[model samples]
Target: MGRGLPGSISGGVKRRGLPGAAKEERIVVLETENAALHLKLAEYQGLAGRSTSEVLQLYSAHGQQQKLQRTSVVTQLHGTVKRLKQDLKRLRSFVLELSKDFQRQSKTYLYQILTAVQGIQLENEAMQMFQIKAFDLEQSLQEVTERYEKEKQKRRALHNSLVELRGNIRVHCRIRPLLPFDAASGHSISEDRQRNFPEKVAYAADDETVLIKCSRPGHASINRTFQFERVYNALESQDIVFADVAPLLTSLLDGYNVCIMAYGQTGSGKTYTMLGPQLEENFAFSIEDESELGIIPRATQEVFRLLSEKPPGSYWVEVSVVEVYNNEIFDLLAKDNYGKVFGVKREVVTTREGKSDVPLLMHETVENAAEFLHLVNKGVQLRVRHPTLVHAHSSRSHLVVTLTINTIISGDNFGTSWEDEQTSQRLNKEVSCTFPQKMRENKSTSSSRASSPTQLEATEKLKKVKTRLQLVDLAGSECVGMSGVTGAALRETSYINRSLSALADVLGAIAEQRSHVPYRNSKLTHLLQDSLGGDAKLLVMLCISPDQKYLTESMQTLGFGTRARQVQRGQLKKKNFPVPSKAK
Candidate 1:
């Protein structure tokens, strides 16, 4: 192979040289191919090593992730165990508090139960004692009831006798203390008027008599004694004065139309006796002052007190206040939006039944004493008053405070039934005709008399059991020159004097039993015709000044009252109505 290599190398050198050259070239080509292959293999080996290193890194990362997950689970378990321990501690504390509160409440409830049981036992014992006492009281009440009935009957009989004793038209005299001006006679004097001129003209001799000494201007002095139902002195308390008049109010409740009239000269105590002393406008009268109250206030209190004693719904009372000024009837209780007097005139009309009524009169229903006094004050403020020489607050009108008391009584009662029957008899007598047979036959049915007993009974059934309590405060009569009143006030004085004179004439006519009563002469006389002529209980309170200067006016007042007392109104007939059986 060497020879061949050498010789061939020589021969081959030429041939092999070509082949060797070819071989060399092929080797070179092969070497180049091998070098290229080695380069490719090295590139592949580098890629494989890079891939192995990445796989190992991924395995290490997975191991580290597992360890971190184990650590997180262990930490979460530790926190959960800590929270459970805290909840256990709070639950133990709440249980301890609940046990303590339960025990405290149980003890309190036990004490309350024991106390209630004891109280029930005591109440049971007391109830048994009450039952025993009630039996004893029942027997005592029966005996007491029998005695009460007897006493009540005796009281009724005595009341009837007293009513007979007090005449229909009762006259009382009141002598006012001498005013300063009355004593002075409007003349200056060194000493006080009351002390200098001691009342020597008028004196109360006894409870029922008044002695008057009158010195005429040109005639001789005259001493006169006047008889009256009562004579109140200057020093008499208001309570004492009211005591005599209190009986009349009781008669009013007995269903009699009662009229109390105050008449006097100017500056006399007519207003003072009827109302109290003059006060500021709208000043309320209070029960706190018992001594200061006059007849109107005292009568109001007494009426309300008596009414309270009666059963509720037995009586309904309506009050109306009107003033007769200048022959015109004016409402004193009518008010405007501002509570001032409305100053509206009311008409005085005589009903077909011969009863005088102030049409459209304002009637106030009073519930209690305060409300009545309030209305009284309101009316007093609305009264027309003017200052005069004789009196500071001289009233210029005749104020009539009428209390219409409508009583609903049971007809089943004996007294009420008897009264109803008597009223029927009286009505029959009043309706008896004195006309001739021809006049009676010619009379129309509308004008015919209700002579039948059945018709009279029917009439009685329709009649309201109402009685009026009229408290009249007549404006005092004044001397035109002495009063120093001019203009409208002078005119008022004229009207007042005229009305008073007409009243005197009417009274004189009634006392003399004249056919013409003269009641229609003046508005005042006509308005008072019922009280003056009818069978109504009338009380004339004559107020006079105990002064020498007022002797003439005082004598006139006494004469008028004396005439009124002589008026023989047969008897005061109580208003009676037949009560329905259903009402009873």
Candidate 2:
């Protein structure tokens, strides 16, 4: 099987080999198939790798595109955000401007409203003032018209009365008593003469008759006849003299000029009559209501009483007390040297009603009777005194006390129909006239005047009706022989006598209706000229004493009084006196 087997085997081998070869070939084919499969797988793998690469590339491209798109979107969003922010900024600016505009407009509107309100208020106030002023002016005009009409009627009536009444002289008589002294002791005594006097004594006012009765301790009465007003005692008669002059004092307060003088020999109670008796208490007792009444005290009391009765602003009084020693004027109220004297200078001033004299003197403000008495006492203390044969403590010089009073009279309120209607019409007119002016001016003044018609009428009436009063106390007319003066007192007595003589002459001239009366003869006469015959009511008090020692002097004093009574004072005619020029 080896050799044959070899050949056969070889053949078999060949066959087997063939088969094996075929198997081998089959195996090879399978291997090749497997290799091919492997190669395909590699290809597939390559293809998948390439596909995956392509896909990756595609995804990368897609991612790059997405990134670009996102970048673009973000840029666009940023631009949009910037645009929105700009728009917001612009809107905010617009809103702020609008708010500012609103605020400004609100302020302007408020200011305008406030200004308008103020203007309206001011206009209302002005209108109210204008209405008031108009009413006041109307009332004033009516009052003036009525007063003018009344004054015209009064003037006409006065003119007719003056023509009907003829000028005539009037005469009056006065008497005074003298001081008493004890014959054995040569001292003054206070005694009652009424019991020792005769039962019946003849005294006549027409003949200027006087009867004097004297009484002494353990002695019969002494009777004497004199042409004078008689007083048994100075103390007893002083009050009588004051009573007699009381009416004169009343007239002075009623707008009259009065002059009172004690004319007699020295120690005839001239000082006592003018100044009252000196009291041991407060020197003002005589003026305060002692047993004796003085001329100065009575006059002052009357003046004050009248002043009190009048309205507060209606009356003003000025007093001046002077002493004439040796033809020189000495101011009693002056506080300088006691013996200092000044000359009398008289000036005539023309007032609205008449002419008046301004005497050079010191004026004093005496508010009450006590104050007046105090001034009078001061004057008496300063007066020259000397012991005299006729009497003790006699006045050697003349004392003059003058009172000047200024007054205003208000028109009476008559409730007549005519007056009421006239007043109403005047008020209306005044209101009409003043309304426009008041509106144009400050409103305050217009409002005050326009409120009341009565106030306006009162103001207009106050412009008219001015009056003045004068009261004068002249020095006593004395006889130098009875006064027993020496040196300066003698000279003073001479001057006093001369002045008295001149006064008598003036009275005589006035009595005779002479064309020209010498009023400039002496200071006393010049000062008394208006009081003697002026528009003011006039009164003269002649104080005299009754005693046997002063019989001759009493007669002379009575003769002076008689002459003064013969001088008639004419009615005061309304005279337009010239006012002092501004240049003067």
State each model's CA lDDT, in order: 0.73, 0.54
* List of clashing residue pairs for candidate 1: 8-12, 9-13, 12-16, 16-20
TM-score of each: 0.60, 0.50
TM-score of model number 2: 0.50
Stretches of candidate 2 above 4 Å error?
A: 1-178, 182-240, 279-285, 335-356, 409-481, 572-584
- Model 2: per-residue Cα lDDT over 1-584, one tens digit each: 21232244335545655666666556556556666777898899999989999999999999999999999999999999999999999999999999999999999999998999899889889878887787777778778878977885576446434522422222223443322351212223223322233222223323334454555558666565533222233234556656645654555543344555555555545556666666644333355556566666766776677556533433345566666565555666655356343333324333455444453445555456666666666766666655555555556666677766544332343222222445445544443443324333412121012435755654554322223344344445555544545787666667777877887898888888898888777766665666555444444445454444444465677667667655555654332221112111
Q: Name the best candidate (by TM-score).
A: 1
Global local distance difference test of model 2: 0.54
Best by lDDT: 1
Q: What's the lDDT for residue 26 in model 1?
A: 62
Measured over all alpha carbons after superposition, the RMSD of each candidate to the real structure, in angstroms, is 19.2, 32.8
